[model samples]
Target: MSLNDASCTFESMTSPTTLKTSTEPPLVSAVHWTRAQWLLLMVVCTVLALDGLDVSMVGVALPSIGQELNLGTDSLQWIVSAYVLGYGSLLLLGGRLADLLGRRRIFLIALSVFAAASLLGGLVDDPAILIATRFIKGLAAAFTAPTGFSIITTNFAEGRERNKALSIFTTFGASGFSLGLVVGGLMTSLSWRWTFLVSVPIAVVVVFLGMKFIPKDKPSAENSGHDIWGAVTLALGMLGLVYTLVSAPEQGWGSVATIAGFAVSIAVLAAFAVIENKVKHPLIRFSILKEGWVARANLSAVGLFGSYLSFQFIVTMYLQSVLGWTPLGMALALLPAGLLVATSAPFADRLIEKFGATQLILTGLTALGLGYVLFLRVGTTPNYVLDILPSVVLLGIGFALAFPSINVQATAGIKDSEQGLAAGLIQTSTQVGAALVLAVTTALVSGHGQAAGTVSAQAMLEQYRPGLILSAAVAIAALLVAAAPSRRRVRT
Candidate 1:
């Protein structure tokens, strides 16, 4: 069959069996889907879901993890920061490898590694080992997450079909992250280790299904010419920058270690830019960076994600520490945000198609900024209905609108071969932004703490307000950036 005919047949075959028309020929009749496709999709969804859960779940279990591990406030930050460091640093490399190698192979291998790391983390008794395992898991996640997108990109032809599939994938990812809080809360009530252990079964199922159904792509001949030096420089530079941010709270900004780290990051990143400009096959092409929409979308992501991460971290702490809510209660309280994120995202695609990404992104930022302002007005008195819920709903709506629009805009007009690279850049910016904001906000709040007896609940709340307010201002800045004429349209 011709390519178009083959695709048409495949589309009709993949459609719901119940919808088959009576006039359709017997051979063209929709065959019952084998166990493979269902299992494979489930497995991939599980992997994405676990990623979502792990990111949010830790917040719920942080208090317990700290108590059991005998960790201080700074160490608590390290636990999360270490993971982001590993994940963010390797994201681009992961995407590159998926394109260079094969998405199926990389995904399965990464999933296996992630599973093993999760197991080690769950079983480890020592705090140091736990942190190390978390880092390993993050590294594995860096490999797996982008590959999920790559798989969809390769398997589904672009247009309405690809858009719908991607939408479902993105929605599941969002849901996974939000639901993870609920799962983590429940699991932590039993034992903090359960949070890590939960991944074991899901990973097994995903790996098994993935092997059965995920299509294998032949290695690209062009991939052999990858710029290894560019990859190394980029990773190291990001690592240095993230380390400096995460460590600055404890080491002090002026300390030699922090200063050295920042200096090295700047120098290394500059070197990376220079190398990319000269190299024939750079890890990230300089040409792509010159694209206005791609650059602005990524820059906006840095600010948008940074604010969101910082807000969530602070709110989780406030609910548990100040309000004295259990993990379960806190999870329940945050459910609206999670549901909103999942429900609103599909509609965002339609909005983008009608009004374009620029307007949707701007509106999202406005909603997010307003949400933060509303959250800042929240007092020590626990009034969840009036103070917290409104902000949660608004923030949910904002992120739901923002995330997919940014993804679509960033990838629009890019060549098929470059899609993986663009996807990696987007994911890396998000995690790095989270790490940056968390570090800065933590340092600011920790530094503002009152004398031991004077540290009332309200005083603690007041200290956190500055971080939230700063986050709001950052969102406003993102709105401004999104509104700029340079980013007003995706260049074809």
Candidate 2:
């Protein structure tokens, strides 16, 4: 039956048999998977894949990018930090705009912009332009990521069908991230620019499919009203805070710029909170904060993702610099971790349903902590089979288990209207955590490098050992938080 007919039928059914009647229709009948929907989802996943590739690929290409551009250790960070800042800061606003405008429209626009930005990044000769392009690329990602979720959630009916679709969507996201590492390695072997240019064709195809398949849905009344002041304040606040975090490792904590950034961040975020409370249409609904599960889930994501990103960065440096491995070799060594992350996710989903989100998250955190502790053994003596492989496998399993569980819990008790906002918030916490931890770890490594003359690869590896241990400690803390009475008491 057509979607219009299905809607009419749904409206007409008011009796106890409504549930029965609803089931009588084909599962796909509820919402037609038009060419538009298929194209949109494909492109969304593809764009996300590109985002993942850019992130992982840059790290693989960093040495080359740095060598060519003559970047110092501290300035090199801008390539990563700039993209994250733009992506994280604009996510919430992007979601709101998708809800207010249209998901299909936004998805297309985002793809086009992302493609252009990728082109710019690839072609740029100057380091400043490269950083600027990365920032712009991130802006495009912010728009696309949240809209992808919103579209799937809105288009698919809830329960098993929605669950399956979301799982598939998330799988693509995870796989894309992992696959990017492999692709980045291969591309960087040819040239660092290929890493960025690779996305152009994918983006172009995604845009074409998005235009064809995704349906055009009118904006809901709640989403139509945009809070300009609230958005501005929130963006400014997040930018200030993230900038402070990214810069702190390079500039001392006592530096004037660092101090001012943090101070302004606190003030602006405080102002944002006040504005949110008073605004007629707030960017984030204050009422959602009262939900215990939502709060815990977001906090858990921050801690969990912080550890994950730091480990990825540290390991990359260790493999290439310390072990005397090429980018391709490092990428190949890390392939098992990515595969494990992908392989474990489906099992993690089933575990979530059976044991609930809290249990799964706690288990995942425990695994992640143990993985880090195991990684402390990684030294100048390269033993992939005995030491590093086991750690990578455990790390992969931990992340695969934790991410989906937290995502489920965060979105679980929210109304449809609030889903986009909640998803945006979760993603924001993830990027912010990554940025913060990376900065902290980089600072520690840099300080150690300076103290030791002619910083050897082994010395750099030793420097990060302390940081990794600390990250493991943080994971243990997260496990405790997840297992706490308050978290356990809250029901989905």
TM-score computed on alpha carbons, candidate 2: 0.89
Name the top lDDT candidate: 1
The sequence of per-residue lDDT tens digits that candidate 1 reaches over residues 220-287 is 55675778788889889887887788788889878899998999999999999998888877777756
> Each model's TM-score, in the order given?
0.89, 0.89
What are the C-alpha RMSDs, in order, of all predicted structures? Answer: 7.6, 7.1
Q: Which ten residues in a row have the lowest lDDT in candidate 1?
A: 1-10
Clashes by residue pair, model 2: 35-213, 36-213, 36-214, 37-213, 37-214
True-structure Cα RMSD, model 1: 7.6
**Candidate 2 least-lDDT 10 residues:** 8-17
Model 2 residue 289 distance off true place after TM-score fit, in angstroms: 2.3
